[model samples]
Target: MAGKLSVLAVVALATAAVFPSSVSAQPPLPPGPVTMIVGWPAGGPSDAVARLVGAHMAKALNQPVMIDNRAGAGGNIGSDAAARARADGSTIMLATVASHGLNSALYTRLNHDPLKDFAPIGLITTSPSVLLVPRDSPLHSVRELIEKARAQPGKLNYGSGGVGSSQHLAGASFKKLAGVDIAHIPYKGTAPAMTDLMAGRVDLVLTTGAMSFIRSNKVRALAVAAPRRLPALPDVPTFDEAGLKGFHTDSWYGLVAPAGTPRPVLEQLNAALATALRDPELERQFSEQGSLPVKPMGVDEFWNFVRKQMPTAAEQVRISGAKAE
Candidate 1:
């Protein structure tokens, strides 16, 4: 019995020596609420999607996720704030095409580099811009619009949310590919741009789906920028189908955290986002709003996609002479 007791004491000492309390310690994950910053104003597509996905993310994380809207400077102001945030994974930016990838080339001086300053979490959704004209306008199709624009260079004007926006890039790409010339008219937002297009103040607008005004015959969709037709706009032909090969551009939104965030934290967030994206109700809501829900890919894949797109988008900005305010 004495020998057995001594042996047990030796075993306990060895176990404690091998496994210290510090060896098992792990820093606690953010216990409080996480904030999602949307660069666009409320009631926009980005805001709507952020709120929808954020709710599910909150449930998966077992914490509340609040939305912060900071709209200005073509999404630069809010994006800069996100990039400057601490690398703690507590603050995330709901970044769009204008703020993340395109701004690098469009702006002469940026507060942050999209590729180096932020760690990509995952892609959320893509809202392809559609080319549209007034319903009563003589331009019946994309080809017709191009031909008219070519014949009357600088006579036709196109409306966009603003310079350096996805809308502007799409319009510029169309002009370059189709070999047409038209004046670009910049507006503060898509709503005002669409309004001007309907009022005949502008000849056309390459913008998001016009579902609300479609029923009223306010505008006519000429072509969709996606590879295939959207379900909501089945009658509209894609740019490739409309006689412009390899012409596709869309405003995509994704999740991004400040640079230097832990890899484990990013992976966990990506997994949660993937689960939220798989929800049926989320898909339905996105479709109803004329946006497509993109399945969340791994962090590396998301980063690769953004990196590959930067040069092409940058060249478009250069060619379009888009500038940041």
Candidate 2:
């Protein structure tokens, strides 16, 4: 028995020498390049935030971060994929309001539980939707838009990325608050919706990422859907200032890993995210785009934040009268 024990001890030492026990204790960085799934198309606000923040996060972690856009079903495709991915920290996702917050209440047949399926990494940024119109449109202000809509019910239409997007919610909220019968036009993505808006195929759009168009004068900002005007669009008036009070719909972006992802991996990812958000250039870019980076928070705090947002999102969906797919 002593000799058998000695042999077993020798084997254990050899195994330890070959593969250090510390390796198991300290998890290695994601097996290889990290893939971040964006639930929207490449040109939307969620995609933009993913690219910008992923670039910085890549530098911080010394690992390449790739963005995979699985845009469909009001951001459910990418979100579902992220939830079902291997929970090894290699595959994370840039979750948005449409996915984590509103989709639960919007989609009746959702495959994944918005809150249960994700381990929150951190909140990225948030931006208020802006009510915009084609540059040559006859409508000059929010009041004009409302009056025109009321005058010709269902004549004036608004475009949105999809049925339950932030843009959609904002447009629906506008219709409800203004008490008009404007038609809704839902597109595959915001870029296409914006394209139609520019071509005058759509009367207007309430969007979060039209800063470039607004800057170049392709679209006129009728009103910001916030309490105050954005610095990027200082001249533009808030919805309240434009005669529509209590109008607010802000979009948020955040990172999340699959629910079973190791807590250590989540910690590492959160740290890298915090480091990237600290970059002044990134902050400046976010501000210029009318999106504000959220303050850093620990994983638990972020999870709580997401939990709190779910109620507000459900209420928004109820107000918008958005139905499930």
Candidate 3:
């Protein structure tokens, strides 16, 4: 009987060891606010997720969490800053698919190594891109839009938030797959670009965020650029359904710290992040915004996921000829 209890105790300790929380009286994280660097402007999905997770993490860790926006270069600007930050627990970055996966492939040169410069925390949320056109447009389907673009060649124009943005890549990929010569129109940001798209200034937009605009009858969603149709937009077909198979693209966000952050700190942060993400209210909030909260994965597992995604990202960048400006 005593031996069984001893074995059970060992098992308990081992399970608790997975996270740096106070399982065995482990020391708490060091003092001061934890600065979470978001690589996009506030109110965007990444920023919103960061704030939500940060709010929960602050309470769990008994430390304040601050959001610092360093928007530009398709998220590379803030990513570079986070990579160079001291290898301490005080600083970390909210990395998006653009920053970690696509930017490395899109740009010929980058100041920091996406894989080598950051310690993997875990994924936060994933939001897929959608195909949209002005509500009153005569185009009713992806096939029709493609036909028009091919028929008109460079006369049709598509708008994206900026160069090297995910929207740009999606549009580029779409152009390549659909064999269309639509002129690419780069906007300073998605807001103005979306405004123009709605106002018929641009023919189409490979937009992100929830399907609220679609539900509100503000825009017509032709297709979803995802592996499957979104539950929120069940009527919307995937690119595959539109005969543009395998044209999946998504905007995802994750948490990462400097590469050399102590393993214990990483474990603790991972714990706090996992806990925060699993919160019911946070999950609901993410869903309402067309973002899905992903479950927590181990640090190494997250790294492996990033590693596996590199080749595909590289191929997309090459095929799209997307480069940093």
Judged by TM-score, which candidate is best?
A: 2
The TM-score ranking, best first, is 2, 3, 1
Q: Output the number of the lDDT-best candidate.
A: 2
Over 4 Å off, model 3: 1-28
* TM-score of candidate 3 to 2 decimals: 0.84
Q: Which 10 consecutive residues of model 2 have the lowest summed lDDT? A: 22-31
Report clash pairs, candidate 3.
none
Model 2 agreement with the true structure over 170-283: per-residue lDDT tens digits = 888889989999888888778889999999999999988789899998999889988888988999999899888999888988899998887889889999999998999999
Global Cα RMSD, each model = 4.1, 3.0, 6.9
Q: What's the lDDT for candidate 1?
A: 0.81
Q: Evaluate residue 164 in candidate 2 and report its C-alpha lDDT on the 0 to 100 scale.
A: 77
Q: Measured by C-alpha RMSD in angstroms, how accurate is candidate 2?
A: 3.0
For residues 130-165, write the lDDT of model 1, one tens digit per residue.
Answer: 888887899998888878888889999888777667
